[model samples]
Target: MEPNNEKSIGVQLTWPIKQSSRVPTPATPQAEDQKIEQGSSKKRKTSDIWNHFTKIKDGATTKAICLNCSATLSAQSNAGTNHLWRHYHRCKSEPRQSVLVPRNSQSLPELIRPPKFNQEAMQECLVEMIVAHQYPFSMVEHRSFREFISALQPKFKMIDQATLQTECMNLYKKRKAVISKQFDDHPSKIALTLEHWSSLDTSSFLKISAHYINPQWKLISRTIAFRLLPPPVDANVIVECITDVLEDWKLLNKCGSITAESSNSNDLAVNKICEMLKERQLLKSTDDYFHVRCAAGAMKEIVQEAFKTTQEAISKLRRIVHLVTATEASKASLQEVAGNCGLPSNKLPSRDILSRWDSTYSMISDALNFQLAFEYLQATQPEYLDCPTALEWLQLKTLKEALEVFHESVSSLSKTDLPSANRSYLNMKKIERHLSKPEHYENNHSINIICPMANAFQKYWARLREFSEIASVLDPRLKLQYLQFSLVKQHGVLVAGEKLTISKNRLICPTIPQLRV
Candidate 1:
């Protein structure tokens, strides 16, 4: 070959091997019984070598101390390391001598509450609010949202890094698929373009958004309180201040002032819709048509106002949940909110959110019944459940559980508020009469038994008409003037009054359940 100087002068062409910079570590050998003994390893005690407990208290052993650590043991005393090992896992520290404290031992008192103010005293209200007999926020809390927003004065003047972080803290991080700055909100099928911003009053979705995403809102003691009356001098003074503001809103937004002063003064705008819903033709005519141009605006206003109570209730439930993960001090503040509204106050369910939990609690018996069904299915026809997709199975399971929960809950809550539970129960009874046996517990989860649940109030009203006497015994809270509940067998209802009884049925001599001596 020709003496190719270009090839000869070229650098050597060879594949370079690159090795990792990691050092290989050899495996550790297992410790032997002899090697793990004394003498050569005298510095480390035999017990310490194997760590065969710090010290032993044979209950009648010689008094001894673990020199390796500060643990102690005594022959006559139970304050020894041996006694403590049972709880050492939960002590949150190194093992030490321990003494058993009886859970309810009254003589040698452990801890008790101070009179009015204590670390735990602050939690009393919160726990109660979380587990109250009824959730108050669901009833009166929404009023606070508007009042608080109107009350708060945004702190733009002196935005500290902390305050700025807080404001930015709640900012949602949404990313577009193309990673653009703008958000694309899909339009509804019946879209109505607005001429002005005010044309879009608060809609149901907007109310939901406002609950969490208000730039003006601030967390007072971790409870989201819209900055009403500006940021007060003391951030800690928020609970009581916000409480007063909300209370005022409730008083001002009195249901009494809603209706016009006419012959039918009793009928408020909201009540009118409630009545019109029964008259499907009137409701659909007005709702479906009634000025297509102004339809969205009117519908938004109608929905927001008519179901103001429902919206408010949902918001209150939401606020109660926000403070669920707060300090004892902050929890006390939440309790004030709960107290203003009726809700459970203790043993708060550990769930995703307070509102969902409150809603869940409102349907406790439904949850329990669901659990029972789950167990029953597992024991019997697990494959019937497995055949469905995970999500489908869960949905069906949850629905079944909800039914059971509603059924049991109405039965229990019935005794306290007859009108309310009576209505709820009658709905269940309708499902029972039409789709189930006399006892609903039997074959409720049959694949074939699927029917739309009857509305409790609808069933209640029907029942009320059945038993005219029922209305007389109904509670004032249920608006008993024309209250109702469905009954068992035939097409009729049991009504509530001061004296409860069944109203309509084939039975000529009708009588409510009675206890005669």
Candidate 2:
């Protein structure tokens, strides 16, 4: 085999080269030149992983350090840039900085900046706070309130009282425009509730709320007007005010019934409103539209009278509650006793507001629930001098039971979201049944409570025929049968039949003998 120079050179080229002791410096200029050339040839792609590694130059050596993990790797070597690629891949495989220990505080970047105040959103929040909480417009000017808002958002500029008032009026006007449009688009008749309130300054205001059924059969209610009534409020003045509101909303002809507290002035107002409507050919007569009494007002009257009968018992319970809650020490002692007897922590007695019968009932009921606690306190504590006697507690129990019926009745009729008018007669009937039978009472004390309540209800019951009875008779669940039965039970068969005939005629319904039979 003769030596061939071409074959020898090829064999030598195939042999591996020995590694150099002096590593090649990272090709700075070459790398820059290569990068520029590559940039021209191809579009540069950016990635988040590239942000963590920073290229560092030390004398002639070049290396990469991960900003997040602080891992260092040689960038220039005889083996080439494979170490830089491996280091980046390993650093990316490691957990993200946010998942690891927080980046060194000194090196951490600010994550959040102060936000600019959104005036519209802030204005809406202020309006909601005022409306929902019944806060005065000047509340925003309160130092404490301003400080609270500042704590929440330091950059927010709060409105002054004058600006707040202007915003309130603008909001009202905007809402009125929306509601007026709703009335115009509504397909059903609107029922209204009128209330007159007098302030301490003797300024009178007439509030009117509208209720109507939507196309979806949902009952919707909204307060439409709260207008100041000039001095000398009379039927004509009230009628004018109401008409203006109704006309403003284009609801004068669409009005159904107007409910107000049973008062001479309100009755006259309703009559006058109907008369004006009739003159305008909007209604046929005053009777064409119903003038209903407030069911809650009637119930309040009944409860008020019923409360008078148990005033002595209520007063004693009130004194006991007062003493129990008189001091921190007394409350603590009472809590201790209550806990010992396994009584609920909330079973502590409550004080009653003389004007509100429901509060009176709560006082008595709470006293009854914590009867053992009261007894224990009476025996042990010398300061609790006005504790109720055994007989007094029995009276309180009786009073509570009797008052519960009225409370429940009032609650049911006060549901503005539901059709309470249709159920008025049924609720009245339930109240009557509860009071009618003396056998339901365990003692004469309870009977005494029932008598006055029954009397108060009877007074209002007779007036139900004016409107509520008509609603009851029209209800599909009760129909004419309930009216006939109720009438006969109260006013005998002959009168019941005659009254039914008159009611049917008024309702423009055909007389059916079965209703009378």
Candidate 3:
């Protein structure tokens, strides 16, 4: 069988060899010379004219064909190669090469490398700027912006509004995919923060963010969802939306806690989510312990409540600010007076919104800063009678100092790099100490004003979750001893002893050993 296979392969190979066999044809000398010249293009021999001409047999005579212009000439041995050289020199289609050599003749300028421009990179940068700054898509089409870009780089082609929108969508999808992969790779439980925002047109959006510590110990916060909530956004609707977001991101079972503003709807939503997690056997803590209230939101409520009791003096200050900023002439007069009073003219009067106490604080702060300027205006102009009396000013000073404490605490908690839960108790303690001080109140009016404020502060501070207490204990600076001391200072020794024992029990519990500094 092997011998037969070898014979069959030999027969198949010989078939093509037999088919290619043909009788040789005689060739002319000039054609033979042309073949040799074509083969030796790298190292020329004989005349250089052969480099641009090829010998060919036309019937009984031989001729030369120009490679450049494709012209024909005589190639008989009797006629030398002179005509070929003349035609090669005069060939209009031939390419020219200019060489540069050294000697003291005029030399060409040295080539300087210009900065390289990448159109795709510039497009990416433009898309990033638009997304980061929230610029309109039509900004690229504006005549002035285009002119500015053209001046900066003339080679860049400006994209249209539709093209820019497409680029932005592509960038958003790419970044979202990257973040989704990160979430998938993250190992620890993710904490969530959610908020509901409304625009000027009354459209509401729910922005949900995921927070987690990566393997490198860096805290990362990424917005996972910004979805429109339809009308009648009740607790059920919020829960369903949050569940969809969690399931969509594949984070339903991995979520540890949720932070949101203190409200009935959010509370019910958290309860529903906890039930879902428990069904999957993922929740180890109760729902009450899992819900973390927004510290900033709680402080806002405290400040607004404090603002209500002191509206009389605030209204007088608001009227004076309104008077000074009513017109350009009045602003100029105030600026002049503020300069003469040795205060910053840039700290001019500012108006405040009724709903935002922070702005009210700003209005009061600016007014107090320019108190002397206001008094000067009151003495010079009879129309300026809105300045508060000395007692009211003193009350405003006391109120400012008290509000400053809350402001500092909120500012500290809003930072993202540090642990906020651990510091929340400490900040609350600072506020409690400030409110409890009798030296801060000078008169009956001051006492009456501070009493309501203190009540407001305590109302929110009492509702803090057990997580804050545990977190405070985890802090190296304020260990279990400090927490015990703090509890005894606030609550009596008996109550504080019970609370301290409970915290210690949780810390030493084997099932909940995940808690660490």
What ranking of all candidate models by TM-score puts the best one first? Answer: 3, 2, 1
Model 1 local distance difference test score: 0.30
lDDT of each: 0.30, 0.72, 0.76
Tens-place lDDT digits, model 1, residues 305-422: 2123233333333333343434576455434444444444344323233312324334332323233333333355433232223343344443444345344434453354222212
In candidate 3, position 154 carries an lDDT of 96
- Candidate 3's C-alpha runs over 4 A off are 1-122, 143-158, 285-287, 336-346, 379-382, 389-391, 485-498, 509-517
Runs of candidate 2 with Cα error greater than 4 angstroms are 1-126, 133-161, 196-206, 227-244, 247-250, 286-289, 332-346, 370-397, 440-447, 481-502, 509-517
Could you give candidate 3's per-residue lDDT for residues 1-517 as a string of tens digits?
Answer: 1112322221121111111244222223454456446753545335445656789999989999987678999998778665675675466766541222333222323453234599999999999999899998889989999999999999999999889989988998899889888988877778898888887788878999988877786778888999998888888889888999998888876787888887889888988888878888887654445677777777787777667777788888889899889999999999999899898998786999875677777788778989888889889998787788777877787778779888788767766466557888888888888889978576786786688878877777777736677778777888988988988997989999998898888766753443322
Clash list (residue pairs), candidate 2: none
Best by TM-score: 3
lDDT of 3: 0.76
